[model samples]
Target: MYQLTFFLEEFLAQYWQKKPTIIKGGFKHFVDPISPDELAGLAMEEEVDSRYIAKKDDQWEVQHGPLTFDNTPEDNWSFIVQAANHWHEGAAQLVTPFRQLPGWLFDDLMISYSTPSGGVGPHIDQYDVFIVQGSGKRHWRVGEKRDDYEEEFRHSALRQIKGFEPIIDEVLETGDILYIPPGFPHDGYSVETSMSFSVGFRSPKKQELLSTFADFVISNDIGDVHYHNPLLSTRSCNGAISEQDYHDLETMMRSLLDNPHLLKQWMGEHLSQNRHELDIVPSDPEWSNEETYQCLMNGDSFNRISGLRAFYHDAQPEIIFINGGQYTLPDECADTAKQFCNEQVVTAKSLGNAIHHPAVLTLLTQLINLGYWYLVE
Candidate 1:
């Protein structure tokens, strides 16, 4: 694992949601997390979120895929296929070890698979992303964030610039990372058969908040607290419950949100868990320590858990909601706790600790069985 302290000396102070910063080979001996073929196979699955945009005769056409390349377009087009890591186990593993960057730094790890002549066109992204060059070469045209930025062509899920502008335009070799902050208009084209890992961080917009709030209400046992017009007792025939009724409804909703107990807990659960579920296919549960094993171990080598965190509050808590589920730990189990909150790793010690709570064990077994975690010998 790449140590944070080592990078701290040169760490970009304003990295989290700030301007773009590219650190070449930031993770030493960094290899492409997943292969192009693996990513391509993932794009075929329907349950996983995936999208593709390719230029068609100077026009951009976007499509959902389990797609195969047609003619290996020679020019004037590129394709971006997103959320590859979410759908495929092999790909998701690439992202799992990088949990040091908190899930919030990742909207999802989208693998852009393109043909030599392919490109997604110039576009502005509202989210931050690290474009890691994988196999082959890609020519990138990126401009620093500008107030004049506006997308010229917009298809569903695809945004393109009206004209090309480049503050930094160049070719990226395999293993190079190009960081782009939100609001920057950029484009990428494959110089040869190419792929890019777009590690995106898409924060919830205000509308998403209202949406999740409704989901929060539905998921949790929020007893139906309707608008109760206490004023009906007054028998005011003068109007249909007055603007005061609206006020009362607002107050009721506000109170529910303001509920110190439930709101706080719900937010914790929601933020801890991801909106999308990780396809945690498990491997058979085996703890027989081999060389990759220790007779007894502390969290290390993907086991000694460190650097678990929550992003919204920049908050760290003992427990977290992950992979659409809640996993709890005592405040003392900080490392394991951080592991659960920050990643999908299921540690043996953590499992052993929850032995009394058989339910936790059962869930852990399923996760292990699903290949989500194993002793990282």
Candidate 2:
């Protein structure tokens, strides 16, 4: 496991989502967790989201994977695999240090292998990211956020911006990190063949939240209440919508948001979903609660699937959200629920006597059968 050398509090206060900064030697004597060849193999998997961006014939070219590197240019090309942490255990460890930030905000760990002079070009992301330098070196240029930065598409799938004045221009060696907040325009090219691990934090857009909330309301049938005026008043102009009518309608809609239960349910369900595919393979002959418990007692351990999102709201301690589903356990098992949500690996000793509880055992068995957690064979 990699440890961060910097102070989290200081970085959070000064740079997180506020400005861009480079932390030299963020991981002292860093060693890459995955190699370029491994990354290439991952890109060849059809279920993985991978891509190749290269400059060929003085024009930017983009190719969606499953990709082949045959006849690929030695220079001026990069291969990127999204959510590598989900499929690669070693790559997933890179995300552990960033858990200081909210887990729900995390999107995925994107690993990129670049050849010399290779880059995706100057572009702005809507989410914050920590680009960790691994293996060789990379020259990066980050600019201040601008309102008038014009977007120019080099390819149909590639969205880049016109060059901007650089506030930070530096070459990052292995173990160095570059932190860029949302809206900052930045570009990086490999000084040599290199690997970069980008841990991204996603911020949901207003429209996305509203649209999801609408879906939640519709699915739950919670906002079926209709507008009613018990005390009717005559209107001089019947064609025009009255201010009072507008206020009443708006209040009716906003009431859904005001309800704490509805808000918690929607937030839990929405945030628990992984932004990328999870490497889920359900147990071939599902284990029953008794069988799972017996295995645990016999010293078997369970590992939470990488990139599986599970969390609980403080307001509803008994309720746990896993992947897009919600479950309510007995209040006594709330701590166990929290443990399962927080821990990446759970051994029999770690769970203690909690595993003996019928409700907790059943829940764990169900989760294990669903392939969210697997026996460490």
Candidate 3:
């Protein structure tokens, strides 16, 4: 487990979503969780999201990988592997401290290994991130939030901005954390061979939320309504959209918003949806309820699948959503279900009487067999 240097409540009240803050030695005696070689190996895997960005001959180049380093250059390049938590256990542990915050908002752990002078260039990110310097050092420059900026599209996939004054510029060493809020323009250049692990949080944009909601309504065959006015009013101009038209449309849109149940269900599923490939492997031979109970009694522990999204709403306490699906817990096991949602790891002792209950045992077996949770010694 990793410990945060500052009080989480203080940080949330002062800096979270408001401004950037640098915490020196966030983790005491920090060690690099994932090696550069391991990161490179992950980048070579087809399912992993990886990218290589470099400056070659005064021209910036970007390569989407499943990359092999056979012909790769030695310096001025970086390899970024996304969702390392899903693939590597050590990398996954990096998220432990940040889990003190809301779990549902977590994105993933992205680890990047860069050679000297390597960087992705100055760009604005739309989500919150805590960049932890894992090994070696990196000079990071973060500019204040800007309302006006012009892009210098160096590459089709990369949008970089130039001519911004930096507010925070420093070389971060091992264990140092730089918390960057959404819309903060920041960039980092490797001072030497280095690794940086970013624990990111998700904040959906208005456009994205609207698009997803539109899709949800369409998929569910709802939100279709025709305009109807009991008393038809004449408009001065035929070309102009009248106030009645605007009112009717606004009412139509409000119908969806007014349905709190539908909205909650949609939002739960949307937030639970996995953004990256999951590392799920169903049990080879499924366990029966008796076997699961026996294992629990024998001091077996349960571990949540890395990067799995599991959460419940207070209004709908019985239903727990995980990976875009919903499961309702029996009234007797509601406490245990809530515990599962709140924790990443569970021990038999923590469960107490719930482990022996039939419904809870069956649910545990199913979850374990489904690869969402696994029994561990």
Instruction: Using TM-score, give the best candidate's number.
Output: 2
Residue 30, model 3: Cα distance from true site in angstroms? 0.7
Please, what are the lDDT tens digits per residue for candidate 1 over residues 38-126?
66666666655566666666566776665666764555444455656556555555565345554654567777777776876677778
- Superposed model 1: Cα runs more than 4 Å off: 1-12, 27-30, 74-79, 87-90, 96-98, 146-148, 154-157, 218-223, 228-250, 272-277, 280-319, 327-339, 342-344, 347-363, 366-377
Locate the minimum summed-lDDT window of 10 residues in model 2: 217-226
Tens digits of lDDT, candidate 3, 234-327: 7779898787789888988988989988888888888889899988989879989898887777888889899889888887766778888877
Superposed by TM-score, candidate 2 places the C-alpha of residue 364 at a distance from the truth, in angstroms, of 0.2
Tens digits of per-residue lDDT for model 2, 1-377: 79999988899999989999999999998999998889999999999999999997769989999999899988999999999999999999999999988889999999999999999999999999999999999999999998999999778898899799999999999999999999999999999999999999999999999999999889988878779999979888979998889999999988888998888889999999887998999988999999988889999999999999999998677899999999889998888889888898887898888878899889888999899999985
What's the TM-score of every candidate structure?
Answer: 0.72, 0.98, 0.92
Off by over 4 Å in 2: none
Q: How should the candidates be ordered by lDDT, best one leading?
A: 2, 3, 1
lDDT of 3: 0.87
Weakest 10 consecutive residues of candidate 1 by summed lDDT: 303-312
Candidate with better TM-score, 1 vs 3: 3
After TM-score superposition, what is the CA distance of residue 194 in candidate 3 from its true location, in Å?
0.8
